[model samples]
Target: MYIFSGDFAFLEIWYVSSSIPNMLVNILSESKTITFSGCFLQFYFFFSLGTTECFFLSVMAYDRYLAICRPLHYPSIMTAKFCMILFCVCCVSGFLCYPVPIVLISQLPFCGPNIIDQIVCDPGTLLALACVPAPSTELICYTFNSMTIFGLFLSILGSYTLVLRAVLRVPSGTGRTKAFSTCTSHLMVVSLFYGSLMVMFVSPTSRNPAEMQKIVTLVYSAVPLLLNLFIYGLRNKDMKDALKKVLRL
Candidate 1:
């Protein structure tokens, strides 16, 4: 769990850092302008880190499932070497998946009026600015987004489903309660992250009002990350005790 938490912490930091600084500048600046390369680069890093996050969440779910459902074999199966391998796989897969669509969209002609209505360089918004219609490109982007968002979401659900079954089988109520508490924080984070993402990305249309998009993007990208430490860290007994000690001092 600590290994997974360390990876998650790093992911969230980069994930938030990728766009928040630029967003703060946009808020303060008069022109509210970003160069073409800057926009795409932001789009690339934002989505790539977001994709990596989805993978890490699923990996964490799997770790919990193994720990809870297969405790006897977990130490052997999830060895240090195996954890490193999983980390590499998640990072590499997440970074590799989105380049094709980004490249395809970058090649589209943007003759004039290249204004993106949203604060972030969303693929949908960028596609709308193309001088020529890009139905094929739109379809490709939608397909990729849908596969990543839904595919990993279902995997999380599957892992938790098995976990739920195992928890139910524990004869003692205290045991069941402890097991549920262990998973509750992770489930909260997952719900916040995936719920906002599905609303923003998995839909068939990009017709949401600009304000609505911004709010949803903030919810997924910023809100969950801001609350992660509280959800995961503050809930720990050791962390709570430490906080109380600091307060008393």
Candidate 2:
């Protein structure tokens, strides 16, 4: 989730940066002469996809919780209808949340400063290009980032809060053990996602793009997803059992 979240955030920023002309574009009368690189457009498309994948993972987690904790109700709770509805919500929300920011960022004229101090296009870079005057585009970024962060935090908190309650109440010792395994996996995922988010954002300002690149690459590309695969895949007993069954051992 952290990987996808940051990737989507970066892509939306890049889409604007790549499409719009530099701050020079706004000052110059021939701004319309500017064009974006085709390669950047392709990358934008690639990065934007992370949003969809993140949402789908959330939906899948919800399904898993329903299956385990509410076995009898799982069929009804995770009905095909419910799954479709959740999928649509994820898809629509991703598109709606992303494109408007791209529009706002594109409006920021990148005339005077062409050097983007990051691995990829980011809100910081586009806002820097506000043509000597600080671009109000950063305002748009704050509103969007805050809104998305708060909303996701609330939903994630709510899901895990209920999950904790479910895990604690299992009757049998073995059942409790299994429940704890599931709870621990979910907690690990949540920690990896939110911890990386805070590390990247709630920090002293970077001196250069190199610092930002290192952060963005580690938190968004590698660590969190690796944690996900570890906690949810390798640690899953059913998966282990299935592997054993398949090997006839």
Candidate 3:
């Protein structure tokens, strides 16, 4: 819950796929060919998975805050059933939200050049390939972008604010420090994931900023994926200890 889970998933898939362009741009610069189904899968998966990830992470953050700030009732407040419901809610809700945008995107017709500016599959880029008859394409893009950015931003902001308040309540130097150690990693991941996304898309795409935009693209999409596992997955002492114990067995 510290970071948005849906965007996190989008970022993960985005970065991994995005990195390929950096290494292979020479041979694949303008080769922007994607099957109709491939196009749907890219956007559908990114948006759907990203939404689930965002909501799920928020739930996790709340769970952590409960554990740390309200230890006495943390179990009752956030039980296995509660967590399972959250997971299911995120998955089902994320998937269901796709029908409208998918239908909108599907109605467009593709009949001209199909050069995607950056690598990977961009919903906007794919929509641009739609023939002029598809007047609703731009509306779909704007709608998707607006809904996602707004929903994600508000969700993240509220969750982090609660988390910050919880962190502030830890007394004693060691207690505060230990609380930070747990919170810091998730905070960093959250910042990196959302920060990159906002920076990449908020501004109008311009030819003059083409070079800068490309670099930003790499940062927003690639660096975070590589960093998340290192910072959150491996760096936590408990995770390290668990790995070591498992290895010893």
Candidate 4:
């Protein structure tokens, strides 16, 4: 907690907290009969948290850029109070951005065949099950998803490019190596996450075969959780030392 305490940390905690428990229960339990209201709530939250994650990832990329590329200004730019406000904006954007797609999808009528292929309340599957073909709704949701994913992906790419250029400009070999080391894990995590999401959503057919989709979804969700623990804890010496101290305390 001490090592990763802040707005981004809190947002990360909430991101995982929103969906992990339900996912765990669904994996262990047999009955998956979620009520109508429950389904919509789950769908809303899953996407909302995902949006929050996207925003937070972009914020983190900016944080790293500032820390490495503009170290002298980073202290003033990323002050605690500024971080809090940024996080609030991220949360609000996350929650507010998805309502258009969710509302458009939810208003559709599901006549029958309520079986949603794959784990969790997938929005695409829900649309597939709707009684009438909702071309307008599909177009809106697809456009929104594409815009969010690609926009953030581009932002992250740009930030990392700046960071890389700065790292290359460091005078000493040791300085360059240290600077690169600080960002490699984060870059890897971001690549793994955005790559999976792009494959999952940015396509003509997002609702692929259930088994294949489930595998991809699990890779994006569970694998990232494990990787984050390893990257943030085991990869970083300061975090490892902090963990040891916390345990001892």
Candidate 5:
């Protein structure tokens, strides 16, 4: 759990950092303009980080399942070496999935009115700005996003489902309660993330209103990142005790 938490903490930092600084600048600047290269760079990093986050969340769920459901074998199965491999796999897979769609979108011709209705470089918004229709491009982007979002989400559900079964089998109510408590924080974070993520990216052609898109994007991209500190950190007994000590000091 600590290994996964360390990876998650690093991911959350980069995930939020990728776009928030630029977003803050956009808020303060008069022109509210970003260069073509800048926009795509932001888009790539932001989405890549997001994709990485999905994998991390899924892995964390699997880790919890192993710990709870297969406690006897967990130490052997989830060694430091195995954890490092999982970390590498998540990062590589996350960064690799988006390049094809991003490249496809970047190749599209944008003649004029180069304004994007989104706060960030969203694929749907970028596609909308293209000079000609790009139904194929749109389909490709939608397929990639859907596969990543839904695939990882289902994996999480599967892990938790198994974990739930194991918890139910615990004969003692206290044991069941303890097992449920271990998973509750992770489940909350997953809910906060995937709820808005699915709405926004599952079917990009839904063409939600610009304001609506911004709101949803903020919910998934920024809100969960902020809430995770509370969900994972403050919710931990050690962290809470440390906080109380600091407060008293």
Candidate 6:
């Protein structure tokens, strides 16, 4: 889906491309020390990428809704110019949303232990390490995180609900199956990606066990990219043929 489609090309590719290499390096190296500035930059890009992903996925859901529910108008409505506008909006929004929160988190004093327990520079871990209690920054960051995650999630859900209704109205069984296959693959990837995020970030628990946090973070970071690679590579006929041609070269 990501490989062949304009909707997914930049955000998904950029995300997995940025994350996996760093993750691999961390795994390969015995030492996992990150300087304070390095940690802040990582946190900045990590959240920015994640926020961008949520926005892009919501854009995809909107695309799917148009394709499924308004087939006749999908082409007209989802024109290249319009898609470029959306792509720009997603990029701008993703980049703009996190810098202030990250700056706030960075300003907080880290007097004592500097070791971050997780692979990535998670905000929660940063909060834990703050020299003074920082309720205000916590509230700001959590509020932004919640709104971005749940707000986009709700939009995706609503779009898909309409899509399901439209799919059901199709007279041909084959048409319904085809629509469902596409939607099911998208939904599976969304659930895998967002479910882990919700558990890791949005859950009510104030204190998550460090080991559990690492495990969940690893899964959330790694699994969706692998799933997307296979789902699109093997299941998408166009993408498969394209890959074959590339391999032949």
Q: Pick by lDDT: which candidate is best?
A: 1
Q: How many clashes in each structure?
A: 0, 6, 10, 0, 0, 0
Model 4 misplaced stretches (Cα beyond 4 Å): 1-6, 238-249
| Superposed model 2: Cα runs more than 4 Å off | 1-47, 201-213, 236-249
Query: Alpha-carbon error at 147 in model 3, in Å?
Result: 3.2
Itemize residue pairs with steric clashes in candidate 4: none
Residue 20 displacement (Å), model 4 = 3.3
Poorest stretch of ten by lDDT in candidate 3: 1-10
**Candidate 3 residue runs with Cα over 4 Å from true position:** 1-32, 133-136, 202-222, 238-249
Tell me the TM-score of each prediction against the true structure: 0.95, 0.67, 0.73, 0.89, 0.95, 0.89
Candidate 4, residues 146-231: lDDT per residue as tens digits?
99999998999999999988888888999998888878777887888888888778774454777877777777766777777777
TM-score quality measure for candidate 5 = 0.95
Q: List, residue by residue over 106-127, the lDDT tens digit for candidate 3.
A: 7776776755565545555566
| CA displacement after TM-score superposition, residue 179 of candidate 4 (Å) | 1.0
Ranked by lDDT, the better of candidates 5 and 6 is 5
Q: Is candidate 1 or 3 superior in TM-score?
A: 1
lDDT (0 to 1) per candidate: 0.90, 0.55, 0.63, 0.78, 0.90, 0.81
Better of 2 and 6 by lDDT: 6
After superposition, the stretches of candidate 1 with alpha carbons farther than 4 Å from their true spots are 245-249
Report the C-alpha lDDT of model 1 over 52-151, residue by residue, as the tens digit: 9999899999999999999999999998788879988998998998899899999999988878777689898998899999999999988889999999
